[model samples]
Target chain A: MHKKNKPIIVLLFLLPALVLFIGILIWPIIASVHHSLYQYPTFSDPGEFVGFKNYIDLFNKQYDFGKAVINALILAALSVFIQLPLALGLALMLGKGIKGERFYLSVYFTPVLISAVVIGMLWEKIYNPIYGIVVKGAAALNMSDVIPPEGLLGNPKTALLAVFIPTIWQYVGYHMLLMYAGIKGVSPELREAAMLDGATDGQVNRYVIIPIIKPIIKISIIFAITGSLKSYDLIKVFAKDAYDCSYKVPSLLLVRYAFHNAGGIASAIAVIMIIMCFGFAILVNWMFKERDLYGKK
Target chain B: MAKSNEISFDSEMYSVKKTNKFVSALIYVGLVVWLLIDLFPLYYLFTFSLKSTEEITGTNVIGLPKEWLWSNYLRVFKIGKKVGASQVRLFFANGGLERSFANSILVAGLTILICLVAALMATYAITRIVWKGAQTLNSIFMLGITIPMHVALYPIYVSFSKMGILKSYWSLIIPYAAFSLSMAIMVCTGFMNDIPKELDESACIDGCGTWGTFTNIICPLMKPALATMGIYIFLQCWNEFMFASVFSDEAHYTLPVFVSNLKGSNITDWGLVGAGLVLATFPMLLVYVFMSRKIQESFMVGAVKG
Candidate 1:
């Protein structure tokens, strides 16, 4: 290990990652931005330079990129407000050292491990118009008049909510597992002290455990919002065709345009999605900073 | 006066304990209900996969099948066979399921291997090796963590098409490895940082070069983190649909893509669709069942740090 060769060794060790990172992640993002400015229809032909026209076209009725953005935002909101609270509740409950904790933890986390396609397929069956459990249960309960017989996923009015349930459900366990780990790491001494001072379980969780795991919660919020914005696979399974489906997310629209040979429009959508993801991430960090409980400078 | 105060306090404490027991019971009941909600879908999927088409479509959807058609699993693997007069069953009509399964294995395996080697080296350098610009390099890699994959999709597709590698496994492998590198580096680096610097110093004193120290001392110590990253990487590569769908043609379709295509083509055949879902889900399920703790720990470690 000569001192002279140390820098070379570092370079040698880092070359593969640097190459792949630049080639796959960095270059594509740069190329996406560049392509977004041009009216390139195909790879061979660069076509005319369109500047911001592609971005403008995205908002027009023909492209409906605005709708896609709205849909993703709606999903992001639901993830933050609904999905995360559910996960926090579960984490707190499980964090209390319940019986069969290990078993419960594994059961809850199983969905995160399974492929979204599989979960989507399974849910699709459960939402089937004819023989689905929803229909059957509604009938058996004599509440068929209320529940949609044509399947919730097929109905334009309920499709977004229907599609989002599984999306939200699939990740509840993921966030739960994260919060659970943080909860577990909270010192037993703090909890004991709180209890000794006559703090109830709820109070201890609220004042002690929750505050201690604020950073983890903040991270979860970022993941939830960003992941919701970039969501595709499970939504894809339900949507099938992006334009045709009632629930259209940005990724679906991006893929649709890419395949339709509208490369510029697709790239524009890509750039917008990237900006939104990054913007949301920064927003979350700023929000967390404003509410920093530790008061660190 | 002191005795009376103690008596009142004891009575109040006893009442609080009674309510606590009731609250505990309520919590247990709530947990049980959630557990059922979580497990029911999987159970239904399994049972539905084993049911006959008639049974599945019948009014008795909730009931257990009278005769479990275990052959549905067999039928999924079988290609080009007519089940009934009106229905023609073909699982992998043109190198469908089996080919896609092999492709998934190859892609996932390669991604994990490449990602590990590259991430391992980069992590060792960034964390263990003291360098001038190491922190800057680390920050750059960290930036990759938040960049949405969609931003990379269109460009990668165009470039690969231009290079005439759009339909090959390289298209999928390279991006999978690349996109996954950030988290992989983060996890490995966290683990590598935990290995006492004293060990590296001792190894250096014992005539071990940087490469030798990394290989003999650091690599073995990184096994747990490596395993965790391996599982996470494998899951990501296997279940990755966005890049695989866009990049790979039918001949090179991975399992997720194949399964998706199967669902679309066989929209009417619930049994076959169930079988396809089962096929796609089983491998990951097995991995989870065996390595649940490691996966949880790794995910937490990566997530908490972020």
Candidate 2:
């Protein structure tokens, strides 16, 4: 295979597609880092140089960018902490000898398959304070008269949390599937040994199963973090006008800014995102070391 | 513990086994409760689609429809007529409702092809080429896996518009290829590593060149990974939103974009919208039903980000 002098033609074969990937995908990111240093001229025009001004505007020092950063981090942390473990527990349940695993897996996964628009609609109905089924369901449960009728989406206080519910619901199955694969990858003999040693199910899970599947758990958490950081579509549907005009996540904030007269600010946001994502990814990589397997989180 | 052995419980020892049963039952109960809550949302959609406006607009979405209407599905298709000019011209015009099935087929099909060919070619270089910068190319593509689609949106919008391909399927199809190349490369390259090098030497001894060896040798061997990546790439395109929204106009609406148009109509039809939701989600349903294993493997392979 070491055709030592294979004319280097192979490199040429890779050049075109590589160019597109590097040129469009990678270069824009690099360019965004540069542009963010300038001031956007207008929505359509390429921006002009304005050193550190936009970045200054981002922080509460001058702008409220800190709030957006705080909110985005909160949302990401919440998704990872809350969503990942719940999915792990559920995956553990099904990974055992659940009788109707296939049916239940499919049923649980139904939410992730639908359009984000439709998901927003479905939850919109459920959260409807007036006619939302949750209100009526609560009323039927006899906890009613004092309860206010309003979808969580309607309340500014609860809006972000309310939206987070659907976000968690929609993708839990994906994480569950990932964790399930992790559990499945474990060697069965060790589990049987734990059982033979008079270990109870809980002890087996605590000592053996969880430890074996820890890599997947870490991967699932990483997936959850990046996913929540990058989330825009689901929020676009559910949180449309749900938050104040100024309220936005880093992802959506940049997206809206990208469409304006000029996108210097948007470019800056993209740079921040790439840096955060890269820094986090590198952190994970370093944690995993060259082994590419993270032992446990 | 001794009492269970003394009683010689059922078969094996550890009469504490009943506790295990109880725990499993409890696990089932918890899973079942969440499953119901999780699935109940979909049932609400189903029931709402079956109901008249009065029923959905009623307080209980999951309540049985006053009357089940199968016609709601038909109405969605018919709503194509009034899908609106912005809606109609952008999507439904040129018979998008009719053309969508075919257009999506082409876009998805072509994207899958580009990803496969490009990734396979590049992966070979990563695996076999010891040339400098090959490793860098491999990691860059790997890093592309986590690069949010939104980050690339505006720059691509400006570029594609500048190229005058804005609103054409090429805009999406090309970008989709670019977006997915990293994952595809990582996957195929992993599989390529496990492929022994002797196969290539043997082929080259018979006068195969780079492209020739790829098409004749590697292409055939790469089919399994290619198939798995193909499905992932296809689903990504099928469900892609932001770019298809920003890059393409109404007439070029993909299925997800078309489904979003449900809201834009002055006269909103929740029933038809639900029906369309089902339609929009149909591909994934089919995938989960039949291709879940492959889909799972795709993600597992993709877990190795560049």
Candidate 3:
């Protein structure tokens, strides 16, 4: 408790985490940027200093990094527009003190606890062409013609959407729980007051609950977007052995290149991913702040 | 005139109540549909895991298996043995469900332990200690939350290789702990801020040293937050695939990687894959089932507070 020893004691406590944080996270980003500037293919040999060539090479067809970016962005968009709304709907619905709320919450959130690999495999079986649920269901309904024989994940055109479906489904409960917590934090008096003013349930939610939970919505948006950009596990399961898979996202590309001795290109993708994630986080916060001001007006 | 107004208002209320009932019914229906969709895959997973290979490959994908084959689970554990072998070994000499399960537990447990200690100390310092540059230190740690983990993947890989620790438990444990530190610190600090400064002052008055105060007063009070964080760090490490896949070789693959690798090799063996999936899934699901409230609270608290 000595005043002079305070700083030393604090330093002792903070040292381990600070060291690891710098060693693992902060240094890596710096290293990634440095690595990106060179033609470094692997760690053993420092390849030629290629300047911004790796960054430039990323957009070209040879790397298809541009396509990966576009795919990641598209996934981010779908997450915000499709996934968040569905989650919001569930949150709003369940936030109303419904019966079996805990049951529903656990059921929906079960996927979040399970490994993405398991979820991928589960969906893969469901989408299996021969004996999967899709084919069987279509056959039962006498609509087998509508089912894709090659399976959804196998088809290039449908692979992205198919993969995105499970990706989105896997986390619907995550965003829903976030919003649900926000919704529950909204005072009952506010809802009652709105109802006393002759507002409908929808009206009360729109005017009273939604505004109160806007901060949470913003967080969910940031999470959904950033999470989509960095998504790899489930997508990897779907990719398996496919070369140039249609659903290649930035993380996938980063992994592929990193393993294949394209360390510079991989670092470029990593830098881009970090940039996108941070950019989206800042943009979402800014958007929310701007909207808050407008709403006040 | 007053009676007429009252009657009209009552009628309006009745109609609104009627519509509310209808809407509530609609909402319940929607929730049930969502619930079914949410649960169906898990249901299928369990049922498929129970089915024989022939039935799984047959056209009865959605139906109950004619004869429930608990043997699939047995075979998952009995990796090198024949199906329905009388003497079943719990620990497979070959890398199978047991090894992967043990690996996942060890890696996740160590990661959580290391992360908690580091994060707790850092959080206590940042929140409780009044030092120069404390605010800046806090900001630096906070910045880690937004840095995508993949950015660190190559650097970490290269570093571990250089250090000759690649494919070892430390490689996974180090990064897992480091990556989780930001959020863990945020959660811990947020909780620590709530414990009144009076507690520390009182401890000091009792002639308690800083270490003593931290051990007796701070650590005890930190149980709930620590539990929440433990579940989180455990789940993150358990469910983690990216680092595990990259850092771990065959001998050290965690459950997720093991399950996925099984899928890759035994591409057509849905039953065996389902068994592997079940093995990977049920442990987490069991943890979630018992500790759902804690898990959910931790996730929400971590997000909201951060």
DockQ for every prediction shown: 0.56, 0.43, 0.57
lDDT of 1 by residue, B1-306 (tens): 122223223325432322288888888897888889888888788778878778888745867777888787776765323344232323333445776888899999999999999999999989998889999999899989999887898888878888989889899999999999999998887888889999999999999989999899999999988888888888788888898888888778888887777676677677777877887887778877897888777667789866
Cα RMSDs, all models: 5.4, 5.1, 4.7
lDDT per residue as tens, model 1, A13-105: 999999999999988888988999988877666699989999988999999888888888988999999999989999999887777988988
RMSD of 3: 4.7
Tens-digit lDDT string for candidate 3 (B1-306): 122223223435433323367789999999999999988888888889888778887646678888888887876776633345344443544466777888999999999999999999888888887888988988888888888888899988998999999999899999999999999999998899999999999998999988888889999999988999998898899889999999988678888888887776677777777887888888778878888898999889878886
What docking tier does model 3 reach? Answer: medium
Model no. 3, DockQ: 0.57
Candidate whose DockQ is highest: 3
- Alpha-carbon shift of residue B25 in model 2 (angstroms): 1.0
**lDDT tens digits by residue: candidate 2, B205-290:** 99997678878888898888898898789878877777777776656777766666665672245777766676666656776778
User: Candidate 2: what lDDT?
Assistant: 0.72
Candidate 2 wrong stretches, greater than 4 Å? A1-7, A60-63, A144-150, A242-247, A285-297, B1-19, B80-96, B266-268, B304-306
Residues A31-102 of candidate 2: C-alpha lDDT, one tens digit per residue: 677778877666456557788777767664433556667667777788878888888888878876468886
DockQ of 1: 0.56
**Ranked by TM-score, top first:** 3, 1, 2
- Candidate 3 local lDDT, residue B16: 38
Task: Give chain B TM-scores in order.
Answer: 0.85, 0.85, 0.89
Task: Give the Cα error of residue B38 in candidate 3, in Å.
Answer: 1.0
